[model samples]
Target chain A: MSTCKTAIRISAKAPRITILPLIQRRHESSARRHKKLLHLPQAPSYAPDRSAPSLIFNPPSSSPNVYHTPLKFLPKDDKRRTLYQTALNLSTHAALRRSTSAIATSGTPLTTSSHLPPRPSATLPPPVRAPYEKKYHLADKEIEEIRRLRLSDPDKWTRARLAEKFGCSQFFVGLVVKSHEKAERVEAEHERMRTRWGARRRAAREDRSRRKEMWGRDE
Target chain B: MKRIRIARCGTQLLAPPSPRRPLCPHVVRFQKTITLHNYRIQSRLQSTAAAREASNFEIESIVEEVESSANDFPSSTWTSPRHTPLELLPSPHPSAALKSAKLAALRSRLSLPPRFPLQTLARTLIHPSADPDPTFNNGSLSILGANLLGYYTTEHILCNYPRLPMSVVFAAQWAYIGPKALATVASEWGIEAAAEPGGEIDPGLLQFKRLRSGDDLPTLLKGKQAPWKWNVTMTNKILKSDEFGSTASRPDAQQLQGMPVPIEEAAQSFVRALIGSLYLHLGRPLTKRFFRDHFLSRHLDMDKLFDFRTPTRDLSRLCAREGFEAPVARLISETGRHSNHPVFIVGVYSGKDKLGEGAGSSLNEARIRAAAAALKAWYLYKPLEVTVPSSTEGEVDTSKWKPNMVDCGEVIV
Candidate 1:
């Protein structure tokens, strides 16, 4: 038989239905994962696997996109992948609290939940319809704070605490934190640059001596 | 202008009606059909870009005719062959304006590197009859069971290449294809290949790069994460190259055994195999380590290296440790060439220290020379009567043997 037809018509006569609904579906899934962030640390008790002979820790699952922040630091090794996921989970919790508190501190206790007490209008920040973005956007310094709490914390911040502090759903906070080799490399590079800067004063003196000697010889 | 620019920036939000056509020409011809197609396309694109808030399709694709028409003219939204306007559904979203902004920002932040290209071995397999490698009996592995010298040798060869599993190139060649196929190959044998490469090597691998540094546990172990514990703390501690010249030495010294062939002369095939596996792993040919005339050359005959076990002895225990079986441990023990073990070279047990022993590199080399000394011991201590006490008078007194040149043919197997 001859080869099958090469030209496959991708879109029907109508394209919008195919496009917009798909995006909406994806955002809804992301929102599901984001909403779950609030429940992570105290998330329903450890349900044992009936089939397993022993207690095995199940990897906490999230929307696959949750790893976007954490996996960047790890190599391809599985242990690294797990470590990265753990770190991301930690940060996601912290980031949620951070984001919420910042929004709250600005006097907008924008708790979408009806269960939360009504805020005093006098204490509230101006209700600017910042389109859910400017209010949620992470600042560079705040990003640094979240990163430090996740990476350098002695007790290793738990998922719940992170969520509570960052004002995010605990699950979203968990996603915001992660560890990686690339991060290590970045840290190393930063140190190297700092060391170079530290040596500049000594080099300047040595250069001055050489220049003076050259001037004397010319005279 | 602002609306057009927003649409332009979020190009992926709509698939541009082929660059061949004006914006949404199909809308006029079949308006309802076009609208249906746009919604379907968005879901497909969303699946791939689920992880990212905004992907290339969301940012760069052109607006589909149906969605655009609906958004632009909400009054004329539906057509079920009867021109009744569909109720304006809540623009199904966090709103298009928010999406457009997120897509634009995420697009700027995105960057990904290109992956490694396929190499010669891959290219050869894809195009049959590409090289001298005979396809005949390409799969048959006869009689060779556990502890077979040939099997170990082939494994040791591939161990030199860091990432390649032996089965990847040999057993179910599909291993190089991907993780799923590789997992299948491993499961068939009831062996789950480690998620990460064990990253160890053959004992003879003097040139391997240590990914980390280790000041302790001896440089031979090279701080490799043990397949057992996989402790990350023990990273890349390598031995200095200069020290390699002093420590690596040959096993035997005295006389060549068997056909009196040079050890190096016999080891050509082994060396070829070694180089071939290295070529496969490193993506580069083994040149510097192969052609060296240094101490390594002076000690072990790369030629006599007919088995993998020979190199396995000099190399560290960690080197032989592949994913599952530690094959080198068995091969090293079976050779029976160490002085501690006895072999076929018959000689009296007179223990005179041999010459090569003094110049040998490791104790393995010293022991090898001691065995050769055993060969000479048999001749030197041959006890006999002083005057040839032959019971039969007719027997010629030729019983007393005379001296001949002391020679033990090449010792390689």
Candidate 2:
């Protein structure tokens, strides 16, 4: 990489010297292609002659210039053949389009296991616990007492403070001490805090949008 | 090297101070009398005081000569035919269009029939900024053409993809025949503007007064810009705005007469004029064919126009509206969860039927992708058999006409 950088830096000084670095970059791309091929453990090694100017090789695992991959390597009775073919078919023009990411599906559960490689269950590592889990459970009366204290001094007794006192997660404290009036009041107080700097922030945002619309270049 | 003395540039309005020894003797010369074509025009200007006032821009000595000439022999000009100088005319004479090879070539290039007169084509090239006269300018034709273009584009979008959201439909319309798009189409058609508009220029070239560089744009072009609080409703946009659903008020074409306009505006006006003239001469059938060949043939990806804020919620709402089961996004497959690079494939299902599938680097991303895919599928539904309403016009047989499925518009949030 340092040699490539040096070659590029020196090549700018003399126009004729750019050819060597150009060849070197092509060699690097070819080397990357080889490394990518190496990742497929099931495929045979495709090491080509280094002295040659170019190497032309296509792996047997996949076909070139076509939509569908070659299924010749799969055994006759393999269950994954149909699934793989279906996936390939679905990716083509006729099938459903690949949708973009959006806000609504931001917190969806991840549990799909169909196409995943089957690994030994014993070999897999144990799952980790959530960061905000309570160390000990609270009794019904204790929960009631915490809720009462939270509602009595809504501004003073914040979710964090109540959670710390009860030795429970802030999420659990939130559920226990929920009151519409208290929530609205706290929200109003938060808004009041932000209102002091709101004008400046809004001006900055408007200026940014205006600049972007006019010139298209970022300042 | 010898130092060169460059003369300072000055306009007629601000004549430079008289030099001690004039480099050019004409700079300090006495005003010459006008004997050329001034006699005929001077007598004609006598009737209208406003025209006489406008002629004040002429040399002071020439105006004196015209006044003397008008009093001396007003009968001689009235007896003979009037002769208006070519340079005095705002635009080329209609007869000049017949002689221009460029005009003929342009006509054949567009494959317009010989019946479509070159005079009308020449008239189309003359923007109101170039020639303010209603007969010579393209203002009225452009208005007609703009309405026709809007009608055709709106119907095509609505009848084809009836389920498209209002915003997406507006975007699609803009993409198809907006000012920028029309300008692009005009340039592609080999339309070239003259250096400046005058009677001496070829009729084939587009004629419009060029906007001066760095000048503050006219009020009409600087549309009414409202702040975010204005709350420009979609209903108001549809009812009040231009075909593109823009909230800003467009400049009136008539008001832009004799004023300098941007090249894009001139080019767009030319395209609209061409369509308007074609509709008048060739009738509706040929105009439809021309529209299909030119505008409709351009490639615009409808699916890429969507920018969903919440795809999952929109999809669920769509399913609910259509009386389908509520959509459920289930992870179909995943790999490398603990590693830096994880792949998750998700499928959105409404009951047993899988609506759409997608894959991403994270579970949430995959789910979002799946939901968006399902929503797109619902929006992009096209019936196998379709017939546009325009196709049925003037047809003797209506047997082949099938009623197009009009899906209720996209789910609004």
Candidate 3:
């Protein structure tokens, strides 16, 4: 019975060898190379170099930023005024050295360093409108005339119309002239509107003002 | 003296009893010895009674005895010291200072000099509410201490950050030496309060009539004006308000006598009284050191105190006032423009120089933050090597003093 079973197993395996040629086989070395390419190198440790200078590279957490101080804020006699400039120079020099070394070894110069960025030569987008300029053309007389126009017929000479007439911004017109009656009327109207507000709306509005007040306190 | 007079009156009334007891000479000697023993005990009781009574009649008799014996002795021979019991006194006696281990521990804990008498230290613990008498209570010392604290804190803040706005200045002052801050400082010093203030209580413990639980706040502490009616201007606050710039004035310590006060009030009073007594005992230099170590050493971020509503407008107004180029916000960098969480970094620049930078989730928020940062930078500028006005208060030499820069005041918008 054992011999019969052995013969049957051998017959089952004999037909499986003939199916090998039907499948294409790749080179084992190519497969090995593909596996090697996918394998990643271990990440570099963040520990500081033992031979590096003791100058602080990374400050403790929650520490204030060193660059928060603006140059204008520094007094003329302050040592920190020159310290920042020296640091900037040193950082730039270090970046140059790193870039040069990289270029020598890899044939490609590094574009940026960790600390110093390349100086911004490109013009920044204008903060205000391109055509906007402060015009000193509006004299005291013009201001007086604007005030008179607003005082005589506030409804007719609204801020927009006055600004258009003087070729100035409505902000300037508002600054030059104010209507107390209009303010009082608006305040009364707002009060009337507030009286109609339900409890939830009133609470929300009150909370908003309270929040606004807390802003100055940085609450 | 009153007890002695009563004893003499009883002896006169019961003289027949003394005559009946003299039957035998030997027995008489025994009776004499017994009478002497009884007299010794009576004298002891009399001394205690005299100490307890502390009456004007006893004082007059002593003075009369001294007057009658003036020719017999040049120096004071009569020394009948009277000590009132602790329970009878309103506050603890100065002599009790030596017996208090807590007071001694507190002294050593504070590192005070041996010369800083514990008696004064003990007096400082007695709040006006506990002891109504000005002589025993901490009321006067607290007033003095409050003034000194205000002066020190004001000079420090004003000199360190010269350009701080009035509101910020008031807030910073409040943050440093306000009632709440002082109370916190007191508690941090490991001060323990007495269950109930009394003369018999330990001198080391803070003595104040504590407000009962669930009791309504004192009327003095409650808001005096309606919330909507309150419209105190900054100028008015500076001129008329307390150091914290509150519209309501601080209540007098004496006015709270026998009334229950909140722990904060009592703790603040104790701290102030401590400062005042330290000033008197140790002088200005050491007191200044104490202030620096205890109060100024605490961390307070000046930047966090600012709450800017219209930073962009304020910055422009500041620029116009200072004769600088108008501040303009420019985008420095941005990422994830089309993503759910976009970040934009904006810098506020006056001309070629950047004043401040801030990063926020959106362009408008970043711009506003940048403006606020710029305003803060302008306000929080600290001059190096600042000499507070108080430092040179008593110095005769004026050569080393450099006058601090007084800014044209904060930007009004």
Candidate 4:
């Protein structure tokens, strides 16, 4: 047992340099040094201006913090309220300074003098398809004809096909037409498909439906 | 006059002509009437003794007030027989409150003032089921107390967290002073229930007809259909439902008379009646103090009550409504992206300011969590100084009053 202990000690102290070469160690140290050198500059100071007479324009964030008291909730005479406002002003000033410098270098003319940037011109992004406007041009006789045709050939003149023929949305086509037989046939087909599902698949489907019900509860 | 004449004629026929007095007609008539009255009293006493002997229950004699002329007889003779036993009374008599040690202990344990009568306390313990009579039971007082509790709780919640969603507000109310919560409070106060409710039971013990095991719930206590078949709107709930925002209305205490009720129902009713009786006896200020100490002091996490779906969408909508910049979720940091348990820290930002930050295993989960946190912060905003509307009630001085801010309500998605 004494010999075994000495042997273990000897092996434990074996030179680790053979496993990790000197060159690799040098490279690792250099990589750490490079990382240190790549550190970003410090953020601008947000010290409050003690001489400022009026409250600053710092707005509260939606951040959830038990200790944080929003400016709106703060008492009118609270000392922290003024300090928070001044800090926000200093930060915004720093941001404005950075943005102005970028614009100057880019040679883009600054049009507005407001603190915040101008809002985007369009409320929504560009549509994937051609923008369709409601015309309200379908006559009562035409709507009746569309409904009659949809009822006659329930499978052929489907919602999509009817919508295409009438130059209207599928939703509008559905509102104008109804076929109880088609609905029943579709439901029966879905039911037959569901019956064919194995135990695992059936359980998974049931679990999915249960999870869907919990969505409204935000579980 | 006819009765007197008949008695006189009978007395004269029965008695031989009174030769000892040689009395006039008027004298004879008077003498005969007095004798007849005495005979009638004797027969009534005999019948009462026989009736008392026949009954198994003890009969107590209650004094009856007699006219001054009739008071010439002994006071004991004027006593009327009471057939009903004391135990047979529906509820305990008010005078019994003084004799109950449990009641005295309860009064002292509650730190109630000496001026607060034990009779009222005893009455509060008698649930409508135990004593169907409204005058004896706590039914009316419980109704008054229920209203007061709802009013106080509503004002407190509204004042403290003005921006809580309607559903969440209802949940908070339920958490604080709902039937279950009140029942828990009663048990915490060391209230014990009687084995069976009767006039013979201790006045301190909660008295309600116990629903036998395996017995079905009473019709009034059973769950009822919602006012609407589908889509029970918040407005409808606010207007039509109880304080807890339940679709089915609360069961009327009077309707549950003589019906067996669960222990929880009885306990809650006792608590409400106590509060109502306190308000009546001790006035507003003391009742408010009692409420603050007992009900308000309970620990309920307001944050846990909120259950949000589509929090991200809700946050964006809230920002738009409040004229703030649209929220954008940005990944702040990540670890072990390729590993089984990858963690992502995400921050939701509105323009230059970061709204909220959350860490989760998946980026989407983190973003959703961050949005939820932001929404929670907005809803849970508490003012440094708040004075509820109830605080100003019945106050002569208005100098310390500060108007509360009523928010435009929660964000709708």
Candidate 5:
């Protein structure tokens, strides 16, 4: 049962149709194509590469054609590739990351050999380490004695002196010696020790921070 | 378009039989005497007799056409019990559907199938607020549609961004098919609302009782006046709450029947009903296409939705959690440090890898910005290809399907 059929017909022909409707059809099809492009099923991986550069300079895609903005192509061994890869994996929420066991186990990129060897990090500021010795194991009685000594002569038995005698951190010394009544005096002494910036310098610092906050907005 | 009186009578002719109407003895006897197919002819015969007695020429001519059309059908004593007058009906008569230019245009606009009856399309426009009757209103359809919308949207979000924080996921869902978004979609479809719904009104127009201006929302939709309990967890939201994960219980669709509602509520119901009706008539594949074309086509910047309080601390915590070296915010570059507008570029480095970078006027501010940037990077990870669970449903070709990467979920903070 073949379904194909061939027909020969004698027809009474009419006048040729106007081009007006045909032109309108062409225009409509083009407009539809334009609209279709605007809603194209974008590749998920491509969105990041397209978005990363704009986000680096401006946190948000302010322009409608942000996807059209050209990204700098990096070579496989480019040092900037590491920077981009690192930036791509930055943590968004601290609490959520900490709450989940994902902190140490997931999303950490393996250390890849770079074409450009990394510069020595010695020039950067050194990380601060806890100065207290846990093994010193100052007895509760010893802590009590240190506190008592500091209180008896607040001027002579300072936090540093107490720390040195106990072979513990000055922070620990301060914590053991801290009293509500002496808080004001301690604050005043710390205030004196703080690096006092001029009014212009302080204003500059405030302005810089405010500017940073403005930049943080993803627009 | 001119209202055809013949079409109106034609609908009356096709009207379901009066339900044991003892009040109108004559109509009941007339109904019992003739079948539905012959009822129009009988009514026309009576109208013809009246037209002849009254000497009405126009009525006589129209009656001739009705008689001839009735003759085309083989007569049978078939009647189904139904009660409702043409004028007293909550929604427009179904016969008005073919005559409505708006309905015809909408059918073509959506590229609906020719077999998909216009009567169902008209029914989708009648919100429960306008038509209290469940059979006439889109109440049941909207409920079904709402569930379908939620399923499609949730799967799309989860499969695409599996690691999005619960709050962010909820916000994204709200951005897509939530009340406001659905209402926007309805208006974008060029749906117009009737000032008042009646049997004579156009079936194409959305029909609903509008809330008075400056009126407070109904108690059900108004939500809780007090703050939600502190113990409300994401798990609770997933299990107990609506699709958008709000704490407040959704207002019952049935309870809102015949009650005046906001335009947004009415419009949302219409959009959902359209989807529901489409699914019922056109089935799953077309419904999915419609969803993708309409709802998913919207533009929403996921990154901008995030609001962070303390990002620097978060970055450090993130580094610690990932077993990375402690994050150090180092001065990358700076200019005019001594000037009023001194700029400082800071980079947050985890060991040798620089996580993120930002420039600011102050070192501390730059550091904060860098930290925030780093956090955004971590949160916005998307997989290359994902097959939503619903896409594979009832399919024999499992070979092409790739399991979606389900992440460990967003950071709790």
Candidate 6:
């Protein structure tokens, strides 16, 4: 709750509009991943609001980037309106985008509920900040999972699924996956023989010494 | 700041300060008809006894005569054109006509109101090559009309002859209706009138109907034919011309809401008709020199064109060229020459100063435009060309396109 005016410095070159389609595509993939994660063997007693998540996140006249409406669309009654409004308010505030990437990449859903933590933030609209910028809990393991998925699947394994498997929220999972994967790569390369990295320098020194011996013989 | 001066500013003939001597009736009457190049011209003069004649009675009487004339002749004669195009003939002896046989009887035909001197100034269809046969007089006024060019050669006659006005003003009384006058006269005299819109109104129409050509046409045009009155129609048409071939505005939709025909159109017709008569009175010598020097001179005064009230940027353009080609590229092999005849090309800008404003729609359009303007200037002013190259542009070719036809001198006077 540190409310001191965080400069929230913005660039004159705002985020490229190209991020919109990427976000839409990413959202579609994330939804699929989320569906797989929460594939309940038994159907709900009553039909769950298939349309709720969409309505809850979408605000009328909102940025073209933020498509999903979060208000519990399945339940026509305004039961989840407050929560939906809060989320909507969060997405629109210029201040929120910079704060969340750290939390977003954590591996475990912090709520500890059977239901997955919200995955929408992991697949933010292009105009919004990237996953690496969100706040997250399982930053390390989430980063590892993101890396592992990238190394394996032709298409990406979304942040939500990685967080679910790693028992963390997607936003947190996003940060971890980004961070750990990079660390792992460096460690793996260091352990492998350092000669490959030093080959260029060694070759140059040897060529110079051999030329010096040949010139000495001529003298 | 460099404005071109039009010579017609001093075009007033105004019966030149006469001290009570009657107008030389010989040239005004029979000689006008007798003149080869100016044969089709009619008088715009007022009648001597017009003071005594009743205003309303004259028109009615002429109407009666036209109808009677139609009854006299059969319908077969209603289609013959009065004159043919004059062609240049081999050199023959001088058979010029100064004194006419029925000069007195023909002089009686000079009965129009005095204020408007002559009526019906039309060109003959005589070509220069077929001349010496008849139709051409070395000393006479030359009329302007596409049909008349066939009667005389454009090279020998129109090039050398002055540009005469083409208007017909009669005693307003005898010259009211247009079609009926010709139709009645043609039927009575058993001769066809110049049935084509721009052909000669058969001479018999005048003798029998007591009316000149194009005279009875306006009144006889009734119903849809009469739908377009003079001034009203011209205004709508001029506005339409602004939008013609333009996608920027829909011409049909912008049609006049309904404007009244002012008296200006008729006034133009009247005044022009009077000028035509004066031209005829000047006869051939003035007409010849005018074409060679004034009307067809290398220099053309462009101010006389495009009235001042038209403030539209498109209509206000003014440009001229001393040579036949463009002032810039000066493209083309054939440029007009002063040695031969000073040919000039003049241009008037109308409408927007965009594409097709001055001349070129594209760069190609520009060349065609320049060529056409030069040709028109050469015809109207007959100015000398300092030099006409062996080559000239024919069609618009930006990469380089030239005209096939020999770009010869087009004399205007």
Interface quality of candidate 5 as DockQ: 0.07
RMSD of each: 46.6, 19.6, 13.6, 15.0, 24.0, 36.0
List per-model TM-scores for chain B.
Answer: 0.17, 0.80, 0.81, 0.80, 0.79, 0.19
lDDT of 3: 0.73
Model 2 off-target regions past 4 Å? A1-219, B1-83
CAPRI tier of model 3: incorrect
List the candidate 1 regions with Cα displacement exceeding 4 Å: A1-219, B1-19, B22-75, B78-111, B114-169, B172-413
- Candidate 4, residue A84: the lDDT equals 78
* Ranking 1 against 4 by DockQ, winner: 4
Instruction: Residues A85-130, candidate 5: write the lDDT tens digits.
Output: 4644453232234333433333322342212323334465432222
Model with the higher lDDT, candidate 2 or 4: 4
Which wins on lDDT, candidate 3 or candidate 5?
A: 3
lDDT of 5: 0.68
| lDDT tens readout by residue for model 4, B185-295 | 999889999988876777889999999999998878876876465888999889989999997678899999889999999999999999998887777899999999999
Q: lDDT for each of the candidates?
A: 0.29, 0.68, 0.73, 0.72, 0.68, 0.28
Instruction: Go through the candidates in order and give each one's DockQ.
Output: 0.00, 0.03, 0.21, 0.09, 0.07, 0.00
Worst 10 residues of 1 chain B by lDDT: B137-146
Among all candidates shown, the one with the greatest DockQ: 3
Off by over 4 Å in 4: A1-83, A86-219, B1-84
Error of 2 at A77 (Å): 40
Runs of candidate 6 with Cα error greater than 4 angstroms are A1-219, B1-264, B267-272, B290-413
- Per-residue accuracy of model 3 over A114-215 as CA lDDT, tens digit each: 344434344665662233568868999999999999999888999999999999999999889899898688799999999999999999999877855553
Among all candidates shown, the one with the greatest lDDT: 3
Model 1 residue B246 CA deviation (Å) reads: 48
Candidate 1 C-alpha lDDT tens digits along B146-173 = 1122233333223322222222223221
By summed lDDT, the worst window of 10 consecutive residues in model 3 chain B runs over B10-19
**lDDT pick, better of 3 and 6:** 3
Q: B45-66, model 5: which lDDT tens digit per residue? A: 3332323332222222443343
